[model samples]
Target: MKKRKVSVLGSTGSIGRQTLDVLSAFKEDFEVVGLAAGSNVQLLIEQIKEHKPRFVSVKDTELAQELKSTLSDHSIEIFCNDVGLEFISSSACDIVVNGLVGSMGLKPTISALSHGKRVAFANKETLVVAGGLIKNLLKRNKGEIIPLDSEHVAIHQCISGARESEIKRIILTASGGPFRTWKEQDIQKATKEEALKHPTWVMGPKITIDSATLMNKGLEIIEAMVLFELPVGKIDVFIHPQSIVHSAVEFVDGNIIAQLGATDMRLPVQYSLFYPQRRELPFNLFCDLLSVGKLEFEAPDFNKFPCLKLAYHAAKEGKSYPIVLNAANEIAVDMFLKEEIKFGDIPKIISSTMENHKPSEPSSLDEITELDARIRREVSERAKTSKI
Candidate 1:
């Protein structure tokens, strides 16, 4: 049996670390060919020593130099910055696991697809910022995308062997974050620490904060629209605090199929890594519903969490609106994390940015990049000036 050659982008992040774990468990079935990480050089160094990938990339040349100096193997190729990310994505690999956080993942995704490499995508921002462009690339390229997001992965599993016409709607479950049960007035004053405390599934700070505001599920709504080719009206979100049922697809015949599992990210990571072939994990990673007892779900409160309503609006508008929504939200989330903005300000900033923008569909990646940068700058400026 031949090992599947794989590259992991954002190798030091939560998803990236778990991806490496999945690969380590099935080392005989996979080979790590490349890794791209940010400033966490220590962890990256450890990964390189263990996985011994042929290629690696860092955030910049300084980190690259630092990484190179500490490595005993001089033969390993090291690259840096956005160019390096593209290089690693286009390198000799059968699959690319993209766990990069922001719009930075978009170009690498395009590069991987252009080079005909499969992408195990955890970066929902890629789809949110430029879904149309990606779908066009997929139509013309041999590259494939298997989602590593729990909700999308569950929907992917549920829809397997089912025709597009048979599907009625997609129900994406959310954990409701720390503010799920909080009063609206109290939620308005949520601090950074409170927002960071996600009820289920530990993630990086940006996404954790987004989950607190229900904006993470909002982004997933846009993601599902693009990934599943569903209308905005056909998709819905349910606040399922248990998170046992990742997502479900309702058939036209009134039957619903769902994918249930533990709140473990590795389950989805493993699914994407060994796609089309379900391989054993060599360890116990199963979900026991008997112990779980009961599952509770309720409709998301759009009034309390306006970020979700903002996301649905962006998805329906279907142009540069989603891009603006994503960029603004990213900036707002950063501001909130830094204690520079209030919890309620996230949706306000997003709404303000969206209102000020003149919508235009970006036909190319360059246009999308330019627009995203511009929105981030504008939002940052506005937030700093108390304009929002």
Candidate 2:
């Protein structure tokens, strides 16, 4: 079999690093064609040295310069900004792993898909903000955008070879984060350390906070809407504390099919990359049922976790509200983590921003991105001025 060429954007992030690990196992089966990182030149330099990708890009110009100095003897090409998209579009890559954070992943995703590259997407924000536009592009270019998030990946795998009419509902399971059972007052007083302590997974700080607020699950709902092309009403979120069962899909015949495995990201990441083929992996055995006791489920308390409710509202509303909600939440979460706002204030800021947003029907990437930026700036100013 011929080796597939790959380019990993956000190569220094949590998902990016693990993707490299998976690719490392299939060295002869895969080639690293390009790499991109955000301000992490040290690790980027190390990755470039090892993978020897023909191209690399960094967000910071100073870090890009430093990398050039270090690899001066090597003929590795380095770029920033527009050059990054240039490299991604023209890459000798069969697959592009878009692991970028927030809405920044939009342009690179469009670039790669326009060139007919298969995309392994970890950037949920892109789909959340502009799923219609991206899907349209995929249709135009005859490209595929596969999910890298475990929940969406689970749904994709379970629904494979199954007709949409056969499926009744898509169920998304959530590990209710550190604040799962905390009282309202207690959650209101949660510290950064508390919010970051995810019960089931290790991820970036922003996502962890989203998990705490249940916004991550909310985002997943919107992601599923576009991915499966289903109505938001048909998608459901259940708080599954064990998280052993990644996600589930129910059929119209009353059969509930579910995907279960150890809580490891590489499982999903690998699945996205090599669909229809399962590879051997070295991971801990099944989470012992006896030790785990009973797996529990409950309806999410939307009153307490308003972020989740906001996500569903935005998704159901189906205008530009989801973009505004996502962008504002990203800014609010950053502020909360930086000690600029209290933990509970995260949702408050988002709600406030959503109130000010006038929803528009964005028909293209440019329009969606414009709305995203406007919400971010407005939310940032609101967050800075708010007494919370």
Candidate 3:
């Protein structure tokens, strides 16, 4: 068995830590060739000592140099910023797992695909912002992009044995976050702590807030459309409070297939990293099926979750609209976290920013970046005078 060499971007994040957990369990089966993180130098140093990867990268140039001094005993190379991401892309590895959040995930993904390496993608923003470009790149390079997201993974598994033509709809499940049942009046009072208490999954702060707004599901809807080549109309969202069933696919033959397991990120991560083969792990067992009660589903009231509606509009409009939407959302979330804005103002800021932008069809990567900066600036300006 040839061991799989892995390069993990965002090595200090939730997905990155979970990826390490899987690698630890299957030590002989996988090798950590490179690791990258934002600014958690302490944790990165600890991970460096444990896995002893050949290369490491941090966001800050000075910090990266300092960390290199600390890891002097280990003969590992260090890099910072885009150069570091490029190193991971061109490294001698069989798989590049992109756990980096936000638009930063895009270039690394393109870099990996260009190098003909398999990508285990947890970064939904990449697909949301540049789905067509990445799909074309994958086709041209003859490489594969796999999903590490649980909902997408479940949909992949459910439709694996069936013909694509038989698919009727893809049903995506959302845990509805901590504010699912809160009244519109009460939602404005939701603090960062209240919003971060996700009912089912443990994720990063940006994504956790996205869940609260149901915008995560909205982004996943765009991701599903890109992954399966299905129309946005054919992709549906269901608010499943249990979250035990990851996702489902209903076929034209009246067969509805679903994937069920403990709400663990590792299962999907492992599945994508080792596709067409299943590895043995201490699996979570199902118990008391009847006592668990019934799984419930409800249509998402867009009136309550306007961010979701914004996502769908951005996705359908195409061009730079999604980029504007994502960039604005990132800025709004950052401001909300800093208490520079209110919880209710998050959507207002994003919406106002989107409304002011004039969408242009970005024909290349440079254009995308240009548009992203413009929207970020515009969004920041709008956030200052936001009435919400």
lDDT for model 1 comes to 0.93
Provide the lDDT at 369 for model 1: 94
Please state the error at residue 197 of candidate 1 in Å. 0.7
Sorted by lDDT, highest first, which candidate order results? 1, 3, 2
Better of 1 and 3 by TM-score: 1
- Weakest lDDT window of 10 consecutive positions for candidate 2: 280-289
Q: Model 3, stretches more than 4 Å misplaced?
A: 161-164, 283-291, 385-388
Better of 2 and 3 by lDDT: 3
- lDDT of each model, Cα atoms only? 0.93, 0.86, 0.87
Candidate 3 TM-score, true structure as reference: 0.96
RMSD of each: 0.9, 1.6, 1.6
TM-score of 1: 0.99
Residues 1-388 of candidate 1 have per-residue lDDT tens digits of 8999999999999999999999999999999999999999999999999999999999999999999999999999999999999999999999999999988999999999999999999999999999999999989965999999999999999988676788888899998999989999899999888898888889999999989999999999999988888888889899999999999999999999999998999999999998889987665878889999999999999988999999999999988999999999999998898899999888999998989999998979889999999999999888878999
TM-score of each: 0.99, 0.96, 0.96
Tens digits of per-residue lDDT, candidate 3, 131-239, equal: 8888898779656898999999999899886666889999999988899999987887789889889988899999999999988998899999889988887888999
Once superposed on the true structure, which residue ranges of model 1 sit more than 4 Å away at CA? none
Q: Estimate the lDDT of model 3.
A: 0.87
lDDT of 2 by residue, 1-388 (tens): 8999999999999899989988887787789989998888889888887888988888867877888888854777788865785576458899999888888888888888878888998999889998899879876865788889999898987887677788899899998889888888899889999998899899988889999999999899999989888898889999999998889999999989888877878888888889768777655545576777788888899988999999998998988988988998899899888988888888888887778777789878778878888888888776666632
Which candidate number would show the highest lDDT if scored against the true structure? 1
